[model samples]
Target chain A: MSDDARDEETVTVAHGGGTGRTRDFLEDSVVPRFGGDADGLAVGLDALDDGAVHEVGDRSVVVTTDSHVVSPLSFPGGDIGRLAVSGTVNDLAVMGATEPLSLTCSLVVEEGVSVGLLEDVLDSMQAACEAAGCAVTTGDTKVMGSGDVDGVVINTTGVGVLPQGAHVPDAGLSPGDKLVVSGPVGDHGITLLAEREGFDIEGDLTSDVAPVNDLVAAALDAGTVTAMTDPTRGGLSTALNEMARKADVGALVDETAVPVRDSVAATGELLGIDPFDVANEGTVVFGVDAATADAVVDALRATPLGAEAAVVGEAVTEHTGRVVLDTGFGRRYLSEPEGEQLPRIC
Target chain B: MSDDARDEETVTVAHGGGTGRTRDFLEDSVVPRFGGDADGLAVGLDALDDGAVHEVGDRSVVVTTDSHVVSPLSFPGGDIGRLAVSGTVNDLAVMGATEPLSLTCSLVVEEGVSVGLLEDVLDSMQAACEAAGCAVTTGDTKVMGSGDVDGVVINTTGVGVLPQGAHVPDAGLSPGDKLVVSGPVGDHGITLLAEREGFDIEGDLTSDVAPVNDLVAAALDAGTVTAMTDPTRGGLSTALNEMARKADVGALVDETAVPVRDSVAATGELLGIDPFDVANEGTVVFGVDAATADAVVDALRATPLGAEAAVVGEAVTEHTGRVVLDTGFGRRYLSEPEGEQLPRIC
Candidate 1:
């Protein structure tokens, strides 16, 4: 079978990229396959949240674990160390949790890996943890021979507490819920791409790799947030599609309303890729009840991270499990993304 | 530096195999480094249990996550699927947990990986989970290109509840505490080695890949068990060294008391490897208080999995942080195991 045909049948390497294809593949193939009652489990397969929260008792705790095997350990936007900490902390934040306490880091370092490099990564991780108000309480280091492992792979696990009665679900969408973008999408993916491919770009589109818990708290306090998610791998479109499916609703999106930086657009066009599918390290897609949607948008706009926030879509009871885009001329169906657009770009 | 010197300084690809050199390296290097600090939150690294448990609230939870990457996917003794599930479950079992409730499997599959292979592995994993009485509740699957990934790497994360008031510490060693082994050691490592390297070994030394939680419970119920650990990765010497360090005690083991199968011993002798450091998937090393050690041993011996249980040593305060061997001829020092000692054999 041809590459494209095979890609459709099976997840391609590109699907591993934090791009549209990856997002689509996950929504179409993965989530539905693992059929289960997600009621109190804090499922994010649909919503694209940072981590997940399962209600255990009166207090809900946020739990998230991520493995990082990004090549060129150090990158222009952020290193694997920064990615590990930020990625985990963001998962807690999107769950409307404050102050993540303990973090565990497991390192699989290949023999012949430079001690200097390991120290550098650890230092970066330490700094990131300190900034996020978490401690690296436990860790495991295993050394594999040269061929048995890549240079280094770091798996980080995190735990945070969620407030009572503030439990947010990815399916928090209501009929009039407004969709808000924390900021422009595709910056992190694009930045990493530029570094990996040696692509020169004019603008300073640094990765927006910051903890969004505080920002999430602000939005939650502003009014009722129907849903919250971080558009990491598989980007904004994947997150929206998941929300729609989970809430048993449809989304009507205005393509123009979504924020896209000029540089990001140009880069996407040049690479023949869609920016909507590219992952963002520091971005959130939240759905708010229509009555409080305006206040939510204003609250987001007031924060530095959410200054460019916009109301991109509204939830509709019709077309459940579908997301439609109104592109001025006509309405076009936005299918779930599939496969990797930029493999290993995470 | 010469290859030999380099191997001494850092692990190499050969260390993962079940060769004489692999055993020697582990015996000389790894074990001594993390042998101490068995009490409280600090579990001595030497035990090489699937994971370490920390007391939180009134309960202690066994937390362990293992990344499985075995070549050929399937083998005579066990497949990657069974290994992933059994490995984590055994880790919890060694910690004296009854049933492991939830397990999360993360797959890093390469492009071109067959759907049939994936399904088979999953089926094996499911069966193992059912046998172990656990649920595969959550997971993440990421596909990378052929060159970017090995065929498939499975990482299983498990959490199990430790019975209240049933606390086991690494440092609970007293001079008279008896040492007991769940069963014969080195079968798993040797079997994997023979299969991978096409070694023509005759005797039936199948991988002892069975869960030993029942045996653990029997032993604990019969007596006051000071500490327990599964002899994975670095094997028995590694486990014992960790125990000694934690209890701030020393151990003088009778070399003849340690059980090794005829085939395992013959193979180790032929390969010039120390069987003590070879990995065993199903074995558990328990440090029991003197007064109840015999009862614990008798209870263990009642089970098929623990028929070969033996009291190998006594804890000593004089030789703190050290494991000594009474070879009948004289007293000799026993150091902790090091390096891979048959890396990836698990």
Candidate 2:
């Protein structure tokens, strides 16, 4: 076996540290496993989206599950509970599901964890659930010894029902398909990093963690949306690359068109990381067919969550499996992400 | 707020460290939170089973989600993938749901993880899904930098349908209800600890991480079951106490009647932990009405998974909210679990 393969057999602490290597592992190891069955049992391996969907009883259901192990538990942008609820709900919403109901929450809380804090987190979760139009139906709480855990780690699973005939065009991208982002990216990652590093940024720089179902619904209703994805862990770059590879197409993005918050850009510069590969909890990239691109953009703008929607690029047939950026200098080259940039932003 | 409240706000590593103090948190803090409407939501705070069931369109659905952050992702009994799938499915089954349709899985993998190893885990997960008669409908994969995690953590959410009027009792313990355990307890916890400690109880101890739906179905078919639970974290003692408290009744268990593998008992003694509080992966405690107790035991015995099933205890009105053990020496007293013994064994 190759050294790389040998290394895969053993697990290290760095994998959970939420750094760049995490992205690389997903691209190299995890993605290819689902080889081309976009609607099969293991179809999620093909699309780098927030969650997966399954067709049951003539209805497609969107299902997503997430676990939060953030050390501080509470952060500037959000806490573990908020992240847990928002992250999973967003996954379902991005898939165009409505009336998301019921969440199964399993909490692994350390012994001696304060009851007040747990109640506070639960309150936050309840609020999040209500905001997302869901309820916490069942949950399991296990308390370990004081040294057994950091604080509390929450794992949540959610189920949402997709509208009938809501066939989310998974890979209909052509050379002229427009790439539209619902809003700015990288705020969640940057905010998390800032909180961890004890750095302060202007404009609150809070996590842009919100449910995006309305934005997705508006976009879909406007016309034919070729594809949709939440730019989460690996940010826009990873998301675009996965889309291109899955659709067997190429994408040409103008770096200038992608929205980047000033705080996030500055934070990225200071940390020597590229914001393109950072994580965004609430951002989504929608690939729209050229004929209805304008209508889709307008519809997205109508939603409060999609006020900043902008067309960033076009899908291409050339340079298949490649994502190219049209730099202002007029150079054309592959925009391959250098490394796993943000490991644990999610 | 006092110092105790302040302490509650922060979670220390000890909570997840698999130790005694962890038990204290569950008994003292987490258990008291289930105080609300009981009948409106089946299996709500009252029973404290894996997931909650809600009435939906003439069908009751059981939903469950869990995260697998067990250190040494790959263990003798199972890996993170198998654990993730089985844990979620068992949660649904314990709620008396049948034929779980689909499971949604999300992975947070660290960078530098081997693709081949991930494939193994995925394959194992697929096999597990098949065993449980469920499909892997959706999933997400996120790779973080190596430092952010140990290797990979998996979060899975499952959805299942419960037959109409199949009142799967969460907690309705009345005096004279018989407590029937499906099989041996503490094997999974002892096996995990033994492996983690580099001891050699290998062959004799393997995690009993099988889906318990079939066993549950048998018990339900046998007759009316007053209460049912899977003795997982905090083991039998913790599970019984919770049931007793919820039912406003007490339990008297015969120590000698409780089934325990000799190997697990030896390991527990060596580690200074009680077998009662040790974690269990695949054991169910069924409280059946006294009239149908013999029939339930007979039904369980006919099944391969419950060959060793036995009546371990009975519920009582005296000493409500407490569990007592009837020792062979003819003494009966409260049997409270001391602390979080063997934390995070689940």
Candidate 3:
């Protein structure tokens, strides 16, 4: 009945912020209806992980879906097409399914969009799939009357296969595990925000929207990745808090070691935003055994996409379900974002 | 270069009509990019079939995705929620994958929609999934600023499995194959149109929107189904034309044999729309071996969802790639509906 109480209220933008409010909405409104764990599922809606792992006969089938409603359609470094494909692929990658067996795309377009735009989007999608070593095998397209939808909203679903019992969960971390990041965070969210607001930052503010499955596969090959997740909507801070809470551990981040582009940091400071609380399209966070953390970072750095990899933090025994930031001056608790500071960024 | 010629043109409602225009756009823009056949695909984008069949190791994986942007979200018999789930389920069922292994949902909602409305819609989706014996294992949610989206648009992707070589393609029909229909057509399209236009027809004008996977499975078990497709967008005419063209054969239909509800026929006449050219959410068309056509019809009729199943036509040796209808008084070619006469009907 408590869940039903929220039904009377209208949806707020913060409900989809990908932070505490988002989780609260999901737990109250969605989880009760169909999010409970189901049989044949290694990872179901209850886990709220990157993707769901279904145990088929001798194969672990990973499935994930994302709806990209990014504003501006085209951005600094990538467009909606690349973001859509990479989002689903990364979700699968984080679940230990680096090779996508199949991908499906569904497009909802507003009337009057130029065919040239659609073609460009499709080309971007094709190129991204090729980079991921996959293809769009099935798709559906619907056109709404003008203003019924934004310029375009894309939904992509990815299916991948991993060896049985090989899939990873975001909640698999244990105390004393080292936290590793594939690259600089907040590039995507900050770039899109700057572009939308017409802010001209000096340094490179391009979005880091690329497929990171290859980077993930290399890391998985090098070390024991107890847990993995992409810092997407709510950025590194939200992802770290989720991992800590789900694993019943705490995280202590060395702020100096976390990768951040100078331009991104400057823009965040100017805009009164935290780089850690934004989004990164082509980045991954790993909870790895302390002994193999350096090896995992080295393996990631070997890849073009993960050249800026670093060990940013560690899972700790104290302050379970919290994230503590060591800014090198003093330690402070890093809170999960309460609402979306920048919506429609991805 | 010819494909690029259309790039300069703006997208019209006809571009997404699920008819000749839609096929042309796909061939010109999409096919050139990624619709070509790929390795390890039993049924790929080129086929434009119900779904794509990926040869995964030893098992055949069937994947399909659909975006539901039906206007007036709730209709006479079903809402967008049921339509979304049933649409994906039927697509997989037509491909010989009646048992869905996983389903993913992605929702794009306007900022001010009521949570109560979403709850009702989710309840409908849950019931539909339960009917299809599937679960929503993974999903994503995004909220747009008010007016960026109409209300809520749902995209659902279904992943299913059949034994390798067991899946069917829409182009598998042959000469002498019997054509069968699950039940009366035109209900969904006519009902939606009536609701949109505020026409108070004096009869049961309900949309036949239900998951028909069980009926399809029973029919497949009873007879040899060489080809199959569900009539969702351009209705039975478009589906039959596609089957004939893909198989490089002709079809001869007995107009009287096609089942259309009396009220639907009356409504179609009132609106100057052909019943055969309107959509039916829960109806299926089958190309069966003539020897087993009677048994297949019987099996379908035994199910509550297919009590009106009937043999409507047969593939013929003449008039290659065309469909001819015998009206008892005369005969004429049945053309694919040129554009969506009713936009956003599905």
Candidate 4:
């Protein structure tokens, strides 16, 4: 069970999340063992952008792959189908790709799954594709024996075309950049946890699972967005730390300025999970020019998915390659979650 | 477990193999509900080619997705990682895309598996990618509980560039096109089965699992290749019949002309399976212009993967939408395998 895993004997849930462990696993074991050391990578796994960029003759294409094994195929605000489409599309979106041209889906279904359930998931996928203005041009389906899979595993690969040099990466952040979050954080993670743990609440707290490519496009077109990332598995803190390290700059974040929905904040506190350490499916944190940060936030606020956009942090050169938190009382360094916090939240 | 399954209540292995039951299941249950309806598809699922073709701005791209779940991860001559890459690269090749540019791999690994085993598989993938001359540009990894999945599952999606109007489809076979097979058939299918079922074989027999893009390129460049498809799950019979049905042309195949290795033929006979009805991972059956069929055969024979290339059949106008076999004993229509003759052969 052991080969190059840092502390654990085998893979842990943190390996799938946006944490240092995932990076370590990829770097120490995967990157060198496999020949991932080629040239002309706009954003390789080391920099860890939302998507990988490849330069074609006259156009730069964004490609991203994601596997959705979210438990309880259907949830409060969305299902695995919606999550699969939205998640892949957002990866392309944060890379400054406005419209994803094509997507290829491969489904691994368990033997005993009902035909009706499969149809329902397909319908959800169709709806999500329509919302994002992307088409599922090719797909393959395979059914596994009952115990071979839990229920279903979906892998969606998306391709988005961009103008020759318009694509962005996490390393594009500079010292004078400002960090803006598109919407409230931790709603998706908290909602999934509550549903899985049977936490009843008065108001409906839905998963923040929606495609944000349109919002990203509007913001990129209207202002100067140097770099962007969508926080999914490892939440806001991990994402910010990744960007900061990639650009070799320090992040000065104002704790009070971070946007968190009331219900999500309450649920996160009740569960003993930090809001900034949880996942968000529909939000993007952008590092933009400080002078145009206000305009970028305003442009994002006009989009349906970004009404709560707010400036939460700024890139600084003081503590290079780190994320510093400025709370109301004192200051601290925001670090990545050490171990597995949640699993199968897509 | 029931919704629209014709007879069975849930999905079966027959749905994974390229059988009529799979077609019926897709048509009756999937297509009518999932909205696969659209236009500008040179080869869609209805035609049942190896991949789908899409025309972008000034170029055409071939897209294919396959999920590899071969048992025993490691086999006689190849492993799951090699199968994943070769299977995907071959799909793009037979669709008139002889050079695939990029591939995206998403892996769903079960917990408790050894990290050493994972590294071995990744090494195989590296070798296969080098052989195919394609880069795995984007990837995702997710881990599931021990009992949720059977070790691991890999989904690879490939994208290939084609000359603007040079793409081929299942319906491209004309009345007089010749059917040429590149290399021997059933080696891969028989080898996997023999290893899994413990059939003792003499004199070094292994799965013929290799990428054949170079051979396809040579043939396409030298002669008129109207349509082509790699014989994978349902083998030569299924592939030829699919092209016949799509093009509304009858195929006349001579049993004596089909190329089969002596070892594979003997193994298929012992196992009570028809050699032509089994899969071949590294073989392409081409429908080409009859006038230059011999030239196409010579060009294919020059490549390493096409040493035994031969002309096996021809498209005819009579008995439209059917395939007729002439074995010198008598004549019979070659129908698709009724049910799951070989499960997980791909």
Question: Judged by DockQ, which candidate is best?
Answer: 3
* Model 2: per-residue Cα lDDT over B126-205, one tens digit each: 77777777766656555444554546667777887665545455477899999899999887777888878886454676
Misplaced by over 4 Å in model 4 are A1-9, A33-41, B1-8, B29-47
lDDT of 1 by residue, B1-346 (tens): 4545543464454544333344443344333322334334333234444455644455555566776766667776678888888877777676677576456666777787765566667778877776676655555666656655657777776656565546465567787788878788888777777777777378465788766667777888889888887777667777777778767888888988888988888877776667787778778888888889889889999987899898888887788978899888998887755544455665
Per-prediction DockQ scores?
0.24, 0.31, 0.81, 0.54
Better-scoring candidate (lDDT), 3 or 4: 3
Report iRMS values in order: 5.0, 5.0, 1.1, 2.8
lDDT by residue for model 4 (B1-346), tens: 3444523366777777767877876676555544354545555555556777766667776788888888878887798889988999998988888777677777888877766777778888878988988778778888887788888788888888776778877678999999999988888888888877788377456888888888889998889999888888888889999889889999999988898888888888888878888888888989999999999999988899888999998999998989999988999998766777666665
**Residue B129, model 2: Cα distance from true site in angstroms:** 3.9
**Which whole-number lDDT from 0 to 100 does residue B277 have in model 1?**
75
Task: Give the alpha carbon lDDT tens digit for every residue of A190-266 in model 3.
Answer: 89898887884684789999999999999999999999999998899999999999999999999999999899999
Task: List the candidate numbers ranked by DockQ, top first.
Answer: 3, 4, 2, 1
How should the candidates be ordered by lDDT, best one leading?
3, 4, 2, 1
Top of the candidates by lDDT: 3
- TM-score (chain A only) of candidate 2: 0.87
TM-scores of the candidates in the order shown? 0.85, 0.83, 0.98, 0.95
In Å, residue B224's CA in model 2 sits off its true spot by 3.6
Error of model 3, residue B180, in angstroms: 0.3
Number of the top-ranking candidate, with TM-score as the measure: 3
Q: What docking grade does candidate 1 earn?
A: acceptable
- lDDT (tens digit, per residue) of candidate 1 on A16-96: 664455555555544554334444555534444555555444445555667777777887667888887787777777777
